[model samples]
Target: MKEIIAIIVFCLALIKGEINSEILIVSENNCHQVFDKDQGQITSLGYPTFSSSNSSCTYVIKAKKGQVISLQWKDFNLPAGHDRLCHGSSDSVVVYDGRQIGINNLYTPMCGNHSFDITSSGNMMTVVLSSTSDEFDIMSFYRGFKAAYKSMSHHCKNMIYKTGYGAIASPHFPMAYPANLDCVYTIKLNQDRVMLLEFAEFALKPVKGNNNKMAMDDCDDYVEVYEGAISQRNRYFRHCGYYKPHPITTGGNIVHIKLHSAKSQLALYTGFRAFYYSGVPNKCGLFYGTPSGALTIPVIPQTSGINVECQFTIKSPQVAYYRVRWLSFGQDLFKKGCDENNYIEIYNGFYDKKDKLLAKKCDTKLDEFDTQYNEMLVRFKIEKFNPSRNFKFIYIGVTNNTVKVITDKNQTCTAKTTIVYRYSGPEVISREVKCELFSIGGLPFWASLLIVCGAGGGGLGAISVAFCLIRRRIRARRRYRRFERSDSEGSL
Candidate 1:
């Protein structure tokens, strides 16, 4: 009972402090990022946004008692000339005036592309961005991430730009290159205080054939959205030396793309870029291919279950170790069985120097059905998970079935996987099942009389016992009176 009371008190305290751990991106005139509490509730101070050209942004994420609290800049922009004091004062009350956290001094120099990391105590987030190149100086901070940026070189100068998905390039630069380039950029969140997720390198390749076209929007020209720019129509088109496209948001993540050429497979290569951030690193820039030559790969991030990326036919039963840069909690890789209906799970120990491996028991059979209803999807929820920990599931042999669960580790697992089974069948019919127990029959007033008579008889028995006691007492009294009268007569 006392523990329950403590938990309640703790939660109340957390809610009051405005501490939150969510990474929320809201679309507004001023592009805003809100870190919400666990229940999706916004704090009183509200979410934060870019205030001005020189304004800096400060984010406070913490859990007090038991509730998540978040406080950000609702007022004021980053104070110019005083870039060193961007995080605000120690006792600063959260508000929108010139007092809240502002954008760092890098807005004008670096074009507002700033990144940093800090511990819960605020002692670790002490990095100053004074110049344009300093923003990219974070390469050392993100040691585990792939550290390359893709751009169209001068070699490609005269090719028609085709808007598609994934990476699609031409022999030369896009004749409509300004309209076709789209790229995806991913930022990995490192919550582990000790070990940080490192990015080695990433490669950008051109999508083959018509696959790239499908990734573009319905419009003939492709438009990109980025940080300051939220929408396609409102985007500021910049094509100075290299065409810098905007980023897109889908399924609650940010993506950037560029369609530089119509036919040349120009790829951006970034070596190992590693760093530690607040959340897990699951986001990546995806270049889509056209529908005619679509990659048809699973687009969801793996949070749990089995994610299998393998070839169907293999002669030798060879065992080769697959190493993902890192796997925090709620993420795993799996192999597909006969088709997408079956899978095998795998995980490598993140902490063990020896790298101990464990595999979860297999699911013998999975029901295959496809529909547009809620119950048709499989949901997996993991709460209070650390990304550094790894768990594994075994696959007896390889088949053609596989599935992946993609969700944030810190948030409740609640990651749902919906399987689409393609088959020709009759339309499903709905029917109701009903059960009737027993019915009552009408009784006459005689039944009521019987109940009343039984109650009356019980009352009479009680009254009879009382009357007998009274009579006995009266008889005794009369005997005593007679004895007294006789005694008086004798005396006379």
Candidate 2:
């Protein structure tokens, strides 16, 4: 009687189609399916049995509202697809978000031994499998894949790319992307190479006035590119309302790209596609804003006898002026003339040689420079391949709109900078001018000035009371000050 009961149980298992792993995912006759079970197994046609050749099917998985579908592969084994053969001779599988199966909707194609988790952006996802080649004697040859799906929730995280080359597109390229996206992707290269980016397709929300400015004042649905991390200091490029953008080459090894769609963006639009690669970086750039950190110019490889020169321009908006502080300069440049072959030329305004000269300096050990103007140009020319040009600087922005003027005759600054460098009698660039660059509250410069004045030379009354004591020190220091201000050749 016990043996009879055991035989009956075995027959019942076979009758229910519980073979292989004992859980039938899809029946043999029904390949196309809509999976409504919250969590269940999904597999290829006749999974764990055999997948017929040249056969294909699609499976749509839907989760509850406000929840996304998540898929994880347990087993995946299929004939490899050859890219060189144009996918004609092998079998493959594709997983994508939403119900559509178009060019832009695909995740990376899956074949030999790949198991990963894919979470949809919405509540629906589709998976498709196709078999095209029959290399074996019979059509029913290999067992295919096994995966599980369930409802889940997700959040967006910042992406960092370390690959040497790759392509990145907005959520669903060529199709209207979802609303209210805020994503940041960064590409970091090795020390020897810098990042180069080119945008193939770009169409953000249009500007209100139909302006075509690359550096837009007001941008909503926009893209921003920075040479470093996303911060007020590294922001140099921001664009909106354009079809395509010019290629960008970074001065350093890291590049950060940010894509933002405002909460007000109710409608959807096809976003953008960009490609990036790492390569040898040559010099030249447009640097904006105040830097909280120091920047070093990276070196490029060249033959022995070549002289490579590069120039970069720094500019501020109309409301601010530049405050430059060279960390290791005043001590190195105190008594020496700049080198002729490998020297830096500083111009008063934006134009390099067309504007009046500020200083043809070789070294500026540690000093403060307030360019009471809105723009400045810097040119670095060095002969032969030196690993470093020994140039480092911190460009800053001060929220002031006026140029400092003691007298109309002493410091005559205009569209072209004019300085009274000629010693008509005993006139010199005074320490009082240096104080003007660093008078902010609790600043390092102000704190250092306090320490210097509060010591023995408390000939007090500064900025108010100590202001007179500061003048006495300026009179004592000017006798030995370098006459760099007078060296400019008037107007260029």
Candidate 3:
């Protein structure tokens, strides 16, 4: 009699297409494997044409640090709930944000046929699919799902870059930035390398004061630069305005930049575009035998801080004179006077209050001067905020025998040649041109050279000369347009 009852129950299960040989446990080996180095895929236990039975499967995805996991579903088909009692029918998928499964970290419980994506905030994610035997129906035999998971780096906020020479911008830059946005970027470079930051474009909502005049002292939306890793104590500068600030350089291997926007401002915000790279650090103080060296504010445009001072004292051999040449000089100019704000001052001797002041300059004009004494002191001071203000100069120890001055052709106009002469050796010539100048209308410089060379049958030297001329002409036209824009803006 018992055997007859068992056979009848087995027949009913067969008719319902329910496989009830204990729950189907898809172990880690049975489930799809997701390696940390590669993306992976997951599907229903019997996928494509899965059976309706009591079964459970779990898929785990992992990634290395500084990476996050993202899951995208291509197809999802399961029983749908008609009411609260059958929210996801008996078949459902539960996603957890991390490795450990807990009710608090449940991302979502999904069912039915739909496509969606979910990204984990950390390096791990867990997905579990379960079906109950009580709800098994022959019609649900086609229920199945498909998903893919991959590793990706964080964007928009709290980013870290290990390599060099990349861009960092306000989130959704070149568009109206989001309101109440806060982001931080930490740049790490090789040992002994420093950071160089240049702004290609910048625009932020200006704060207005009395009479609707633009206020410079206060800012509601601002970007802060730090010398080392980001910290409250390491704050370098805070900037906010329509005026584009100058390029900046860090003194160490790490640079942290923070961007913030206020809640009130929502539109007409064309954020900012900035590039960063690793470069050599600045040198200061006395030198023994290094023949020729350059010194400048480690950071350009001097936008990092206020009430800042940088001084360098150069001492040559007793018989040699310290010669200084300004490669490029720029500073904040006050209509009233030069000394009211940022300026560079040269002292005849080791920097002293009693020493003679050779010159007090605060403009872009180029200048060359030498110190009367064997020791020379150069000082740069910034008493207030100034955008895009900086100075670069080169110095060498010269005696009566090594007094020859080699003129730089690029000094008068933007040329591509640099001539250097050593006191003990022959002259060294170096030609350098901006890489952008070589490309004309998206064509490589070599291609243009080849076309011109092939058409004219000119020598290699002539081909080189022709290429330079063409590049120079194109650069001149670009400079003309830029000058015109500058003039128009000045008039406004």
TM-score of candidate 3 on Cα atoms, chains taken together:
0.31
Q: lDDT of each prediction vs. the true structure?
A: 0.25, 0.58, 0.60
How far residue 177's Cα lies from its native spot in candidate 3, in Å, is: 1.0
C-alpha lDDT of candidate 3 relative to the true structure = 0.60
TM-score of every candidate relative to the true structure? 0.19, 0.40, 0.31
lDDT per residue (tens digit) for residues 1-492 in model 3:
665664565556545765433324344466544456558787776454444456667778888765667677877877766652347477777777667786535544677663346655457778887777544443334437888878877666767755444555576554677888788877777754665565656777667742123443477787776656465434545666664544454445677778788887658877775666455553332232233345554443333555556676656442245566565544343333466446678888675675488877756666676776557767777554343454555554443233333333331234454333222222336655433434435577787656656665556668679879999999999999999998989962
Give candidate 2's TM-score. Answer: 0.40
| Cα lDDT of model 2 by residue, 1-492, tens digit | 665664565455556764454333434356788897788979886565444456677889988765557677888876655652225436778776668776545565677554445655556789888767544433323457888988754333365555455445566555765667887877776776765567766777766753432335477788877656677546545666655544555556777778888776645578776766455544432243322223345554442246657776665442234565553332333234556556667677776554477766655545656665657777866555444344555554442113333333222221322222110111233323222344334467667566656655643343446676788889867853544444464532
Task: Provide backbone clash counts, one per model.
Answer: 103, 15, 0
Q: What's the distance in Å from true for residue 164, model 3?
A: 1.2
Best by lDDT: 3
TM-score of 1: 0.19
Top-TM-score structure, candidate number: 2
Kindly report which residue pairs in candidate 3 clash with one another. none
